[model samples]
Target: MSYVLITGASSGLGKVFAQEYAALGANLILVARSEEKLLTLSAELRDKYNIDVRTLMQDLSLQESAEKVFAFCNREKLTVETLVNNAGFGLSGAFDSMPLEHLEKMIILHNLTLMKLTYLFLPDMKRRNRGSVLNVSSITAFQGIPYNAVYAATKAFILTFSESIREELRHYGIKVCSLCPGLTETAIFDKAGIDPYQTLMPIGPPEPVVRAAINGLEKNKNIIIPGLINKILIHGGRLLPRSLMLKLGIVLGRNKKAFLQNSC
Candidate 1:
Protein backbone atom coordinates (compact mmCIF):
# COMPACT_ATOMS: atom_id res chain seq x y z
CA MET A 1 0.00 0.00 0.00
CA SER A 2 1.04 3.59 -0.54
CA TYR A 3 2.24 5.52 2.52
CA VAL A 4 2.60 9.08 3.73
CA LEU A 5 6.08 9.62 5.20
CA ILE A 6 6.23 12.32 7.86
CA THR A 7 9.37 13.48 9.61
CA GLY A 8 9.09 14.77 13.22
CA ALA A 9 5.98 12.69 13.57
CA SER A 10 6.32 12.19 17.32
CA SER A 11 4.60 15.36 18.51
CA GLY A 12 3.13 18.81 17.92
CA LEU A 13 2.19 19.67 14.33
CA GLY A 14 3.86 16.61 12.84
CA LYS A 15 1.94 14.28 15.13
CA VAL A 16 -1.29 16.05 14.24
CA PHE A 17 -0.53 15.68 10.56
CA ALA A 18 0.07 11.97 11.02
CA GLN A 19 -3.27 11.57 12.78
CA GLU A 20 -5.07 13.61 10.12
CA TYR A 21 -3.69 11.51 7.29
CA ALA A 22 -4.38 8.29 9.17
CA ALA A 23 -8.01 9.31 9.59
CA LEU A 24 -8.16 9.69 5.84
CA GLY A 25 -7.10 6.03 5.55
CA ALA A 26 -3.59 6.79 4.36
CA ASN A 27 -0.89 4.38 5.52
CA LEU A 28 1.88 6.19 7.37
CA ILE A 29 5.66 5.94 7.67
CA LEU A 30 6.41 8.04 10.77
CA VAL A 31 9.96 9.26 11.45
CA ALA A 32 11.27 10.98 14.60
CA ARG A 33 13.98 10.69 17.25
CA SER A 34 11.60 9.32 19.89
CA GLU A 35 11.23 5.65 19.12
CA GLU A 36 8.87 5.02 22.03
CA LYS A 37 6.51 7.81 21.08
CA LEU A 38 6.57 6.75 17.44
CA LEU A 39 5.74 3.19 18.38
CA THR A 40 2.84 4.23 20.58
CA LEU A 41 1.49 6.54 17.88
CA SER A 42 1.92 3.89 15.25
CA ALA A 43 -0.02 1.35 17.26
CA GLU A 44 -2.76 3.83 18.05
CA LEU A 45 -3.16 4.84 14.45
CA ARG A 46 -3.18 1.24 13.29
CA ASP A 47 -5.81 0.31 15.83
CA LYS A 48 -7.95 3.40 15.33
CA TYR A 49 -7.75 3.82 11.58
CA ASN A 50 -6.98 0.21 10.65
CA ILE A 51 -4.23 1.45 8.32
CA ASP A 52 -0.61 0.40 8.29
CA VAL A 53 1.78 2.61 10.30
CA ARG A 54 5.55 2.16 10.13
CA THR A 55 7.88 3.89 12.53
CA LEU A 56 11.48 4.94 11.90
CA MET A 57 13.53 6.44 14.70
CA GLN A 58 15.88 8.90 13.05
CA ASP A 59 17.36 12.24 14.00
CA LEU A 60 16.81 14.38 10.95
CA SER A 61 19.31 17.03 12.11
CA LEU A 62 22.24 14.91 10.93
CA GLN A 63 22.96 15.63 7.26
CA GLU A 64 22.93 11.96 6.31
CA SER A 65 19.58 11.19 7.99
CA ALA A 66 17.50 11.66 4.88
CA GLU A 67 19.60 9.10 3.00
CA LYS A 68 18.94 6.56 5.75
CA VAL A 69 15.19 7.17 5.58
CA PHE A 70 15.20 6.82 1.80
CA ALA A 71 17.14 3.59 2.03
CA PHE A 72 14.79 2.21 4.64
CA CYS A 73 11.77 2.99 2.49
CA ASN A 74 13.36 1.35 -0.53
CA ARG A 75 14.35 -1.79 1.40
CA GLU A 76 10.87 -2.13 2.83
CA LYS A 77 9.24 -1.55 -0.58
CA LEU A 78 7.30 1.42 0.78
CA THR A 79 5.78 3.54 -1.95
CA VAL A 80 5.59 7.04 -0.54
CA GLU A 81 2.69 8.88 -2.12
CA THR A 82 2.92 11.89 0.21
CA LEU A 83 5.94 13.42 1.92
CA VAL A 84 5.69 15.88 4.83
CA ASN A 85 8.97 17.51 5.82
CA ASN A 86 7.93 18.66 9.26
CA ALA A 87 11.02 18.00 11.36
CA GLY A 88 12.29 21.42 12.48
CA PHE A 89 13.04 23.50 15.57
CA GLY A 90 13.76 27.12 16.44
CA LEU A 91 16.37 29.02 18.44
CA SER A 92 15.12 32.24 20.02
CA GLY A 93 17.89 34.71 20.90
CA ALA A 94 20.40 37.05 19.39
CA PHE A 95 21.88 35.00 16.55
CA ASP A 96 25.42 35.33 17.82
CA SER A 97 24.40 34.43 21.37
CA MET A 98 22.88 31.16 20.21
CA PRO A 99 25.25 28.20 20.12
CA LEU A 100 26.74 27.63 16.68
CA GLU A 101 26.00 23.93 16.88
CA HIS A 102 22.33 24.63 17.67
CA LEU A 103 22.09 27.04 14.76
CA GLU A 104 23.73 24.55 12.43
CA LYS A 105 21.42 21.75 13.53
CA MET A 106 18.40 23.98 13.02
CA ILE A 107 19.57 24.82 9.54
CA ILE A 108 20.12 21.20 8.70
CA LEU A 109 16.76 20.09 10.05
CA HIS A 110 14.72 22.85 8.45
CA ASN A 111 16.51 23.27 5.12
CA LEU A 112 19.01 20.63 4.16
CA THR A 113 17.18 17.55 5.38
CA LEU A 114 13.89 18.69 3.89
CA MET A 115 15.53 19.43 0.57
CA LYS A 116 17.38 16.12 0.45
CA LEU A 117 14.27 14.09 1.27
CA THR A 118 12.31 15.84 -1.44
CA TYR A 119 15.10 15.29 -3.93
CA LEU A 120 15.28 11.61 -3.06
CA PHE A 121 11.54 10.82 -3.30
CA LEU A 122 10.41 13.22 -6.02
CA PRO A 123 11.79 11.13 -8.86
CA ASP A 124 9.57 8.14 -8.21
CA MET A 125 6.57 10.41 -7.79
CA LYS A 126 7.35 11.95 -11.16
CA ARG A 127 7.71 8.55 -12.70
CA ARG A 128 4.36 7.49 -11.27
CA ASN A 129 2.75 10.85 -12.10
CA ARG A 130 1.08 11.15 -8.66
CA GLY A 131 2.17 12.53 -5.30
CA SER A 132 1.94 15.39 -2.80
CA VAL A 133 4.57 17.26 -0.81
CA LEU A 134 3.66 19.49 2.12
CA ASN A 135 6.41 21.58 3.62
CA VAL A 136 5.85 23.34 6.96
CA SER A 137 7.09 26.89 6.91
CA SER A 138 6.05 29.90 8.99
CA ILE A 139 4.43 33.30 8.45
CA THR A 140 7.86 34.69 9.32
CA ALA A 141 8.94 33.48 5.88
CA PHE A 142 7.29 36.56 4.35
CA GLN A 143 9.95 38.87 5.77
CA GLY A 144 13.14 38.92 7.76
CA ILE A 145 12.52 38.39 11.45
CA PRO A 146 14.89 39.97 13.95
CA TYR A 147 15.43 37.51 16.79
CA ASN A 148 14.41 34.54 14.68
CA ALA A 149 16.69 35.35 11.78
CA VAL A 150 18.06 32.00 10.73
CA TYR A 151 14.83 30.13 11.39
CA ALA A 152 12.83 32.56 9.27
CA ALA A 153 15.40 32.46 6.52
CA THR A 154 15.20 28.68 6.37
CA LYS A 155 11.40 28.87 6.20
CA ALA A 156 11.68 31.45 3.41
CA PHE A 157 13.72 28.94 1.47
CA ILE A 158 11.01 26.35 2.01
CA LEU A 159 8.29 28.76 0.83
CA THR A 160 10.14 29.74 -2.34
CA PHE A 161 11.21 26.18 -3.06
CA SER A 162 7.74 24.73 -2.57
CA GLU A 163 6.15 27.28 -4.90
CA SER A 164 8.76 26.79 -7.58
CA ILE A 165 8.38 23.02 -7.52
CA ARG A 166 4.58 23.19 -7.38
CA GLU A 167 4.59 24.88 -10.75
CA GLU A 168 7.12 22.42 -12.12
CA LEU A 169 5.00 19.46 -11.02
CA ARG A 170 1.63 20.92 -11.98
CA HIS A 171 1.35 19.14 -15.31
CA TYR A 172 2.28 15.86 -13.69
CA GLY A 173 -0.61 16.13 -11.19
CA ILE A 174 1.83 16.24 -8.26
CA LYS A 175 0.87 18.70 -5.55
CA VAL A 176 3.42 20.68 -3.59
CA CYS A 177 2.31 22.92 -0.73
CA SER A 178 3.99 25.36 1.63
CA LEU A 179 2.10 25.42 4.93
CA CYS A 180 2.81 28.78 6.59
CA PRO A 181 1.16 28.59 9.99
CA GLY A 182 1.38 31.38 12.51
CA LEU A 183 1.81 30.80 16.26
CA THR A 184 -0.08 27.69 17.17
CA GLU A 185 -0.62 25.88 20.45
CA THR A 186 2.47 23.72 20.50
CA ALA A 187 5.49 22.98 22.67
CA ILE A 188 7.82 24.70 20.21
CA PHE A 189 8.10 27.76 22.41
CA ASP A 190 8.98 25.73 25.48
CA LYS A 191 11.47 23.67 23.51
CA ALA A 192 13.07 26.90 22.33
CA GLY A 193 13.07 28.21 25.92
CA ILE A 194 10.41 30.82 25.24
CA ASP A 195 7.26 30.93 27.34
CA PRO A 196 4.15 31.04 25.19
CA TYR A 197 1.88 32.46 27.90
CA GLN A 198 4.03 35.58 27.93
CA THR A 199 3.19 36.30 24.30
CA LEU A 200 0.26 38.60 23.58
CA MET A 201 -0.64 37.26 20.16
CA PRO A 202 -3.43 34.72 19.87
CA ILE A 203 -2.12 31.19 19.84
CA GLY A 204 -3.68 29.03 17.11
CA PRO A 205 -4.70 25.42 17.58
CA PRO A 206 -2.93 22.64 15.69
CA GLU A 207 -6.11 20.93 14.49
CA PRO A 208 -7.38 23.79 12.33
CA VAL A 209 -3.94 24.44 10.98
CA VAL A 210 -3.58 20.78 10.01
CA ARG A 211 -7.06 20.72 8.51
CA ALA A 212 -6.42 23.87 6.51
CA ALA A 213 -3.15 22.47 5.24
CA ILE A 214 -4.77 19.24 4.06
CA ASN A 215 -7.74 21.06 2.54
CA GLY A 216 -5.49 23.51 0.72
CA LEU A 217 -3.38 20.70 -0.70
CA GLU A 218 -6.50 18.89 -1.87
CA LYS A 219 -7.59 22.08 -3.66
CA ASN A 220 -4.10 22.56 -5.15
CA LYS A 221 -3.36 25.73 -3.17
CA ASN A 222 0.39 26.16 -3.32
CA ILE A 223 0.66 28.44 -0.29
CA ILE A 224 -1.58 27.66 2.69
CA ILE A 225 -1.59 30.37 5.34
CA PRO A 226 -4.03 29.21 8.04
CA GLY A 227 -5.34 32.22 9.98
CA LEU A 228 -6.88 35.53 8.89
CA ILE A 229 -4.59 37.63 11.11
CA ASN A 230 -1.51 35.76 9.90
CA LYS A 231 -2.56 36.25 6.27
CA ILE A 232 -3.03 39.95 6.94
CA LEU A 233 0.36 40.27 8.61
CA ILE A 234 2.21 38.41 5.85
CA HIS A 235 0.49 40.22 2.97
CA GLY A 236 0.67 43.63 4.62
CA GLY A 237 4.38 43.18 5.05
CA ARG A 238 4.60 42.37 1.37
CA LEU A 239 2.81 45.62 0.54
CA LEU A 240 5.05 47.77 2.72
CA PRO A 241 8.53 48.85 1.77
CA ARG A 242 11.28 46.43 2.67
CA SER A 243 13.01 49.11 4.73
CA LEU A 244 9.82 49.75 6.66
CA MET A 245 9.30 46.06 7.30
CA LEU A 246 12.87 45.69 8.49
CA LYS A 247 12.43 48.63 10.81
CA LEU A 248 9.24 47.15 12.17
CA GLY A 249 10.96 43.83 12.68
CA ILE A 250 13.72 45.45 14.63
CA VAL A 251 11.26 47.41 16.74
CA LEU A 252 9.33 44.28 17.51
CA GLY A 253 12.49 42.53 18.47
CA ARG A 254 13.47 45.26 20.89
CA ASN A 255 10.08 46.36 22.25
CA LYS A 256 7.87 43.28 22.12
CA LYS A 257 10.07 40.71 23.76
CA ALA A 258 7.27 38.39 24.78
CA PHE A 259 5.55 38.35 21.40
CA LEU A 260 8.84 38.23 19.57
CA GLN A 261 10.03 35.36 21.70
CA ASN A 262 7.04 33.20 20.83
CA SER A 263 6.10 34.45 17.35
CA CYS A 264 8.57 32.27 15.49
Candidate 2:
Protein backbone atom coordinates (compact mmCIF):
# COMPACT_ATOMS: atom_id res chain seq x y z
CA MET A 1 0.00 0.00 0.00
CA SER A 2 1.07 3.57 -0.51
CA TYR A 3 2.20 5.63 2.48
CA VAL A 4 3.40 8.98 3.76
CA LEU A 5 6.93 9.02 5.15
CA ILE A 6 7.65 11.59 7.87
CA THR A 7 10.90 12.23 9.71
CA GLY A 8 10.93 13.23 13.42
CA ALA A 9 7.57 11.59 13.89
CA SER A 10 7.78 10.97 17.61
CA SER A 11 6.66 14.42 18.68
CA GLY A 12 5.51 17.93 17.81
CA LEU A 13 4.64 18.67 14.20
CA GLY A 14 5.83 15.27 13.07
CA LYS A 15 3.32 13.54 15.33
CA VAL A 16 0.62 15.84 14.02
CA PHE A 17 1.49 14.90 10.46
CA ALA A 18 1.14 11.23 11.34
CA GLN A 19 -2.30 11.80 12.79
CA GLU A 20 -3.41 13.92 9.86
CA TYR A 21 -2.28 11.31 7.36
CA ALA A 22 -3.82 8.51 9.41
CA ALA A 23 -7.16 10.27 9.39
CA LEU A 24 -6.97 10.31 5.60
CA GLY A 25 -6.33 6.52 5.64
CA ALA A 26 -2.73 6.76 4.53
CA ASN A 27 -0.17 4.32 5.89
CA LEU A 28 2.73 5.95 7.72
CA ILE A 29 6.45 5.43 8.17
CA LEU A 30 7.56 7.43 11.21
CA VAL A 31 11.24 8.27 11.77
CA ALA A 32 12.98 9.59 14.86
CA ARG A 33 15.92 9.00 17.21
CA SER A 34 13.75 7.71 20.07
CA GLU A 35 12.76 4.13 19.35
CA GLU A 36 10.43 3.81 22.30
CA LYS A 37 8.58 6.97 21.37
CA LEU A 38 8.31 5.91 17.77
CA LEU A 39 6.84 2.56 18.73
CA THR A 40 4.38 4.15 21.08
CA LEU A 41 3.21 6.60 18.41
CA SER A 42 3.02 3.85 15.82
CA ALA A 43 0.82 1.68 17.99
CA GLU A 44 -1.42 4.54 18.89
CA LEU A 45 -1.88 5.67 15.30
CA ARG A 46 -2.52 2.13 14.07
CA ASP A 47 -5.14 1.42 16.69
CA LYS A 48 -6.80 4.80 16.64
CA TYR A 49 -6.84 5.41 12.90
CA ASN A 50 -6.81 1.79 11.70
CA ILE A 51 -4.09 2.68 9.23
CA ASP A 52 -0.80 0.88 8.83
CA VAL A 53 1.96 2.42 10.94
CA ARG A 54 5.69 1.73 10.72
CA THR A 55 8.52 3.20 12.79
CA LEU A 56 12.23 3.84 12.29
CA MET A 57 14.32 5.07 15.20
CA GLN A 58 17.41 6.70 13.79
CA ASP A 59 19.57 9.76 14.20
CA LEU A 60 19.29 11.40 10.79
CA SER A 61 22.41 13.42 11.55
CA LEU A 62 24.54 10.42 10.58
CA GLN A 63 25.91 10.26 7.05
CA GLU A 64 24.47 6.85 6.16
CA SER A 65 21.00 7.56 7.54
CA ALA A 66 19.16 8.25 4.29
CA GLU A 67 20.56 5.16 2.60
CA LYS A 68 19.72 3.04 5.61
CA VAL A 69 16.16 4.35 5.76
CA PHE A 70 15.69 3.69 2.05
CA ALA A 71 16.93 0.16 2.58
CA PHE A 72 14.49 -0.36 5.42
CA CYS A 73 11.63 0.92 3.28
CA ASN A 74 12.62 -1.39 0.47
CA ARG A 75 12.88 -4.38 2.77
CA GLU A 76 9.41 -3.72 4.11
CA LYS A 77 8.04 -3.41 0.59
CA LEU A 78 6.84 0.09 1.31
CA THR A 79 5.91 2.57 -1.39
CA VAL A 80 6.15 6.22 -0.50
CA GLU A 81 3.80 8.59 -2.30
CA THR A 82 4.27 11.45 0.13
CA LEU A 83 7.36 12.45 2.09
CA VAL A 84 7.59 15.03 4.90
CA ASN A 85 11.19 15.81 5.71
CA ASN A 86 10.41 17.35 9.09
CA ALA A 87 13.12 16.23 11.45
CA GLY A 88 15.14 19.25 12.62
CA PHE A 89 16.38 21.22 15.64
CA GLY A 90 17.52 24.76 16.43
CA LEU A 91 20.51 26.31 18.19
CA SER A 92 19.70 29.60 19.91
CA GLY A 93 23.05 30.93 21.06
CA ALA A 94 25.78 33.03 19.48
CA PHE A 95 27.27 31.46 16.37
CA ASP A 96 30.75 31.26 17.89
CA SER A 97 29.36 29.69 21.07
CA MET A 98 27.57 26.83 19.32
CA PRO A 99 29.45 23.55 19.40
CA LEU A 100 30.99 22.73 16.04
CA GLU A 101 29.76 19.17 16.26
CA HIS A 102 26.21 20.19 17.12
CA LEU A 103 26.11 22.71 14.30
CA GLU A 104 27.52 20.18 11.85
CA LYS A 105 25.01 17.54 12.87
CA MET A 106 22.22 20.05 12.58
CA ILE A 107 23.26 20.80 9.00
CA ILE A 108 23.35 17.12 8.16
CA LEU A 109 19.98 16.49 9.70
CA HIS A 110 18.25 19.62 8.42
CA ASN A 111 19.72 19.90 4.94
CA LEU A 112 21.84 16.98 3.70
CA THR A 113 19.54 14.14 4.67
CA LEU A 114 16.52 15.90 3.19
CA MET A 115 18.35 16.37 -0.10
CA LYS A 116 19.45 12.72 -0.10
CA LEU A 117 15.94 11.45 0.50
CA THR A 118 14.45 13.68 -2.17
CA TYR A 119 17.07 12.51 -4.65
CA LEU A 120 16.52 8.85 -3.77
CA PHE A 121 12.73 9.01 -3.89
CA LEU A 122 12.27 11.40 -6.80
CA PRO A 123 13.39 8.96 -9.45
CA ASP A 124 10.75 6.40 -8.56
CA MET A 125 8.03 9.02 -8.35
CA LYS A 126 9.05 10.54 -11.66
CA ARG A 127 8.72 7.19 -13.33
CA ARG A 128 5.24 6.76 -11.88
CA ASN A 129 4.16 10.36 -12.71
CA ARG A 130 2.84 11.22 -9.21
CA GLY A 131 4.33 12.18 -5.82
CA SER A 132 4.80 14.95 -3.27
CA VAL A 133 7.75 15.96 -1.11
CA LEU A 134 7.38 18.43 1.72
CA ASN A 135 10.52 20.05 3.05
CA VAL A 136 9.99 21.79 6.39
CA SER A 137 11.84 25.09 6.23
CA SER A 138 11.30 28.19 8.37
CA ILE A 139 10.19 31.83 8.05
CA THR A 140 13.56 32.82 9.45
CA ALA A 141 14.92 31.79 6.07
CA PHE A 142 14.03 35.28 4.79
CA GLN A 143 16.72 36.90 6.93
CA GLY A 144 19.77 35.89 8.93
CA ILE A 145 18.96 34.99 12.51
CA PRO A 146 21.97 36.14 14.54
CA TYR A 147 21.65 33.74 17.50
CA ASN A 148 20.36 30.91 15.32
CA ALA A 149 22.76 31.37 12.43
CA VAL A 150 23.38 27.88 11.17
CA TYR A 151 19.78 26.81 11.58
CA ALA A 152 18.49 29.78 9.61
CA ALA A 153 21.01 29.31 6.85
CA THR A 154 20.10 25.65 6.57
CA LYS A 155 16.41 26.54 6.26
CA ALA A 156 17.21 29.11 3.57
CA PHE A 157 18.92 26.30 1.72
CA ILE A 158 15.85 24.11 2.11
CA LEU A 159 13.50 26.75 0.74
CA THR A 160 15.71 27.46 -2.25
CA PHE A 161 16.35 23.78 -2.93
CA SER A 162 12.70 22.83 -2.69
CA GLU A 163 11.59 25.66 -4.97
CA SER A 164 14.16 24.83 -7.64
CA ILE A 165 13.28 21.15 -7.68
CA ARG A 166 9.56 21.91 -7.63
CA GLU A 167 9.99 23.70 -10.90
CA GLU A 168 11.71 20.72 -12.49
CA LEU A 169 9.30 18.13 -11.06
CA ARG A 170 6.06 19.80 -12.14
CA HIS A 171 5.93 18.34 -15.64
CA TYR A 172 6.29 14.86 -14.15
CA GLY A 173 3.30 15.31 -11.79
CA ILE A 174 5.64 15.32 -8.78
CA LYS A 175 4.86 18.24 -6.46
CA VAL A 176 7.47 19.71 -4.14
CA CYS A 177 6.66 22.12 -1.29
CA SER A 178 8.77 24.05 1.17
CA LEU A 179 6.77 24.41 4.36
CA CYS A 180 8.21 27.49 6.06
CA PRO A 181 6.75 27.76 9.50
CA GLY A 182 7.56 30.14 12.33
CA LEU A 183 7.95 29.03 15.97
CA THR A 184 5.63 26.25 17.04
CA GLU A 185 4.82 24.86 20.45
CA THR A 186 7.18 21.91 20.62
CA ALA A 187 9.73 20.45 23.00
CA ILE A 188 12.30 22.12 20.77
CA PHE A 189 12.88 25.04 23.10
CA ASP A 190 13.77 22.71 25.94
CA LYS A 191 15.90 20.57 23.66
CA ALA A 192 17.84 23.62 22.51
CA GLY A 193 18.30 24.71 26.13
CA ILE A 194 16.34 27.90 25.47
CA ASP A 195 13.81 28.96 28.04
CA PRO A 196 10.29 29.15 26.62
CA TYR A 197 9.67 32.23 28.68
CA GLN A 198 12.26 34.12 26.70
CA THR A 199 11.25 37.51 25.44
CA LEU A 200 11.73 37.26 21.68
CA MET A 201 10.40 34.01 20.30
CA PRO A 202 6.66 33.84 19.79
CA ILE A 203 5.17 30.50 18.82
CA GLY A 204 1.94 29.08 17.54
CA PRO A 205 0.83 25.44 17.81
CA PRO A 206 2.17 22.68 15.57
CA GLU A 207 -1.26 21.61 14.29
CA PRO A 208 -1.64 24.61 12.02
CA VAL A 209 1.74 24.01 10.43
CA VAL A 210 0.77 20.38 9.80
CA ARG A 211 -2.64 21.30 8.45
CA ALA A 212 -1.32 24.05 6.23
CA ALA A 213 1.28 21.72 4.76
CA ILE A 214 -1.25 19.05 3.80
CA ASN A 215 -3.62 21.66 2.42
CA GLY A 216 -0.88 23.20 0.33
CA LEU A 217 0.20 19.80 -0.87
CA GLU A 218 -3.34 19.06 -2.05
CA LYS A 219 -3.53 22.43 -3.78
CA ASN A 220 -0.05 22.14 -5.30
CA LYS A 221 1.25 25.27 -3.62
CA ASN A 222 5.01 25.58 -3.95
CA ILE A 223 5.91 27.49 -0.78
CA ILE A 224 3.68 27.51 2.28
CA ILE A 225 3.96 29.93 5.15
CA PRO A 226 1.25 28.52 7.43
CA GLY A 227 0.31 31.44 9.64
CA LEU A 228 -0.69 34.99 8.80
CA ILE A 229 1.82 36.43 11.23
CA ASN A 230 4.58 34.47 9.58
CA LYS A 231 3.44 35.60 6.15
CA ILE A 232 3.56 39.18 7.38
CA LEU A 233 6.99 38.70 8.91
CA ILE A 234 8.38 37.18 5.75
CA HIS A 235 6.91 39.96 3.65
CA GLY A 236 8.08 42.57 6.10
CA GLY A 237 11.60 41.30 5.93
CA ARG A 238 11.50 41.46 2.18
CA LEU A 239 9.93 44.91 2.10
CA LEU A 240 12.40 46.54 4.46
CA PRO A 241 15.93 47.65 3.64
CA ARG A 242 18.59 44.96 4.12
CA SER A 243 20.71 46.80 6.66
CA LEU A 244 17.71 47.70 8.81
CA MET A 245 16.46 44.12 8.71
CA LEU A 246 19.84 42.78 9.72
CA LYS A 247 20.04 45.13 12.69
CA LEU A 248 16.58 44.09 13.85
CA GLY A 249 17.38 40.44 13.37
CA ILE A 250 20.54 40.71 15.43
CA VAL A 251 18.99 42.54 18.34
CA LEU A 252 15.82 40.44 18.54
CA GLY A 253 16.83 37.09 17.10
CA ARG A 254 20.42 36.07 18.04
CA ASN A 255 22.31 35.11 21.16
CA LYS A 256 25.71 34.55 19.59
CA LYS A 257 27.55 36.13 22.47
CA ALA A 258 26.08 33.91 25.18
CA PHE A 259 26.26 30.76 23.11
CA LEU A 260 29.82 31.38 21.98
CA GLN A 261 31.00 31.96 25.52
CA ASN A 262 29.28 28.82 26.84
CA SER A 263 29.76 26.49 23.87
CA CYS A 264 31.25 23.17 24.85
> What C-alpha root-mean-square deviation, in Å, does candidate 1 show against the real structure?
2.8
- Can you give the TM-score per candidate against the true fold? 0.94, 0.94
lDDT of 1 by residue, 1-264 (tens): 799999999999999999999999999999999999999999999999999999999999998999999999999999999999998886777789989999899989999999999999999999999999999998878888777789889999999999998899999879999999988888787788765555444577899999999999888898999989888877878889997787566433333664454446
When summed lDDT is taken over every stretch of 10 residues in candidate 2, the lowest stretch is 255-264
Q: What tens-digit string does per-residue lDDT give for candidate 2 at 106-131?
A: 99999999999999988889999999
Mark the regions of model 2 whose C-alpha exceeds 4 Å error after superposition: 255-264
Candidate 1 weakest lDDT stretch, 10 residues: 250-259
